[model samples]
Target: MTNILVVNSSALGPHSVSKALVDNTVEKLKLSHPDANIVIRDVGANPIPHLTADNVVPEPETDAQKAARSLSDELIGEVQVADIVVLGAPMYNFGIPSTLKAWFDHLLRAGVTFRYTEAGPEGLLKGKRAIVVLSRGGFYSEGPLQVLDAQEPHLRALLGFVGITDVTYVRAEKLAISPEERESSIAHATTEVEAVVNQVSAAA
Candidate 1:
């Protein structure tokens, strides 16, 4: 059976546009993959600890800290078992949330998710697809606000680091511009989600 890992990192909880988009995407996936085993990791409500000096100090940790470190290991293991990874990543100060970044730090382990090769670096986890659902308050796909978009590019680079080159981004921007625009943006994204679902279903 195909396995999927869903990571939700919207600080706004159920009210978040990014989270809603992710949920819709999952629904679409289920329509195609009826037997899909999906695992959801909600990093917003229960965030993993940031990698502090104590955690990465190259020294042994206390028992309690060691237990906390185990959480990161488990999350990385989940990625290894997944065939697809879906992320709900919203723009925070033109960047990704700290929680999502922490998840990446845990998964990007040497000799595990990646390896240092003579040619440079090679990813260990292959044949995985990632879909990032991005929601931004303003339009950033072009013009002046474009440079401020750190969400999509950062995710591409980091996920690609782990050998996930089959990646797609569904961006819902200008959500806060006005009520009409917000509704229209969401509807458009929903159509895109449906199209992707049809494609995946046909391929399946």
Candidate 2:
């Protein structure tokens, strides 16, 4: 069975566009591969603590550090075992949420997630495809709104650092302007999600 890891980073919970996208993608995946193993981590609901001096102080491991490290290890293990990863990232101040960044910090350990080689830095996690579902209040797909899209580039850079270059980004933009535009944007994004589902299913 194919193993899929899904990360949902939306503070809005069930009402979140990002969560909706992830849900739709998972539904599509189920249709394609009923036997697939799917694991979901909702970072926004159960927020991960940001790294601090205590995390790297090298003293007796505190409960906070231990918990943080444990969560990070689990996340990394999930990625290592998964055949595909789907992530939901809602833009915050033109960047990723603090909770998501915290998750990244924990997963990105030196000599574990990545290492420098003669050629360049080699990411340890390989043979995995990642899809990031992003939602924005304003239209930031292209052209005039391009400059406001820090979410896409930031996610790509961080995931790429972990050797996940085969990544797809599906965006649900202009979600807060009007009811009509929101619905239309969501429909368009749902179409993209279906396309992604088919693509991944075919490859699998």
Q: For residue 42, what is the lDDT in candidate 2?
A: 90
Put down candidate 1 lDDT per residue, 10-36, tens digits, no spaces. 889979998899999999899889999
| Cα TM-score per model | 0.93, 0.93
Off by over 4 Å in 2: 57-65
Q: Which pairs clash in the backbone of model 2?
A: none
Lowest summed lDDT across 10 adjacent residues in model 1 is found at 52-61
lDDT tens digits by residue: candidate 2, 1-204: 899999999999879999989999999999988999999889999997788765664542888777766766787898889988999999998898889998898788778889998999888887898889999999877788799788999998899888898998999988889999999999999999999999999997
Regions more than 4 Å wrong, model 1: 57-61
- Return the top candidate by lDDT: 2
TM-score for candidate 1: 0.93
Model-by-model lDDT, in order? 0.86, 0.88
